[model samples]
Target: MRENSCSEPRLRKSRLGSFSKVATTKPNSNATSENRVICIYTYDWTDVADVMRIRDELRKLGITSRIPYKSDEDTMIGKYRVRGDTRISKYYE
Candidate 1:
């Protein structure tokens, strides 16, 4: 009687090396307890400049914002909460 032998699939060394290198970041390193996060959507890379301009305008009004690398379709900007003075509609108009 003949017995069948089972063989495992082989993986390339380059593929194994690529799998070993992973991208990661520290947790909540850019967050604070007093601010709310707002995300702005952009059409493409060309719109990034306009988004940054808006960020600068917001900064002038004492509102802080940042571009988070979490997504390509949206930009994450931060806003601080102030009593009776937290608004951004005027700047958009």
Candidate 2:
């Protein structure tokens, strides 16, 4: 058994969902929509091949995310984007 373990740290996948009306019920509010959360695991790596491999692994999982993890290494810049029925609260004073 090889002892030199090269295990990548597991990323925590968080799923954002619409605000629950039951939990945050407003007397006269009409906002019941939210965005979905995605797992963004981008970081500096020692080699290029490793990053590509990791990216392929994530793709096989049938996960919906943004960008090509392999090519983006040249530009170490990553950000999260959300576009789904975005809305603001309309509370009555």
Candidate 3:
């Protein structure tokens, strides 16, 4: 996956479905959807390259994968395991 630097701001959509430019930076430790902008987007399952790229990027940041669980049950399981030492939230899923 390509790293988006500050020069390349990403367009993120909020929970309300409004879009805005969010500067790409190392994620803040205290950021939350209720307090900051959270990006929510969807991709086609057939787009293997894009999906894999995103998964790899998250892995590099020490975030665990949510792939091996029973998501089909919709029990609101923990998606990823973000370490406490990292700036990102451990409960970020």
TM-score comparison, 1 vs 3, better candidate: 1
The whole-model C-alpha lDDT of candidate 1 against the native structure comes to 0.34
List the lowest-lDDT window of 10 residues for candidate 1: 2-11
Which run of 10 residues does model 3 get worst, by summed lDDT?
11-20
**Displacement of the residue 23 alpha carbon in candidate 3, Å:** 23
Tens digit per residue, CA lDDT, model 1, 1-93: 111111011012221111111112334444444443443333443555555554554355455544342233222354323323255232342
**Candidate 2: RMSD over Cα atoms?**
15.5
- Superposed on all Cα atoms, model 3 deviates from the true structure by an RMSD in Å of 11.0
Clashes of 1: 0
Instruction: Report the lDDT of model 3 for residue 72.
Output: 17
lDDT of 3 by residue, 1-93 (tens): 232232123223111122223434557543443333323222433445544554454455464745321121222443322323232232223
TM-score (C-alpha, index-matched) for candidate 1: 0.29
Query: What TM-score number comes out for model 2?
Result: 0.27
RMSD of each: 19.1, 15.5, 11.0
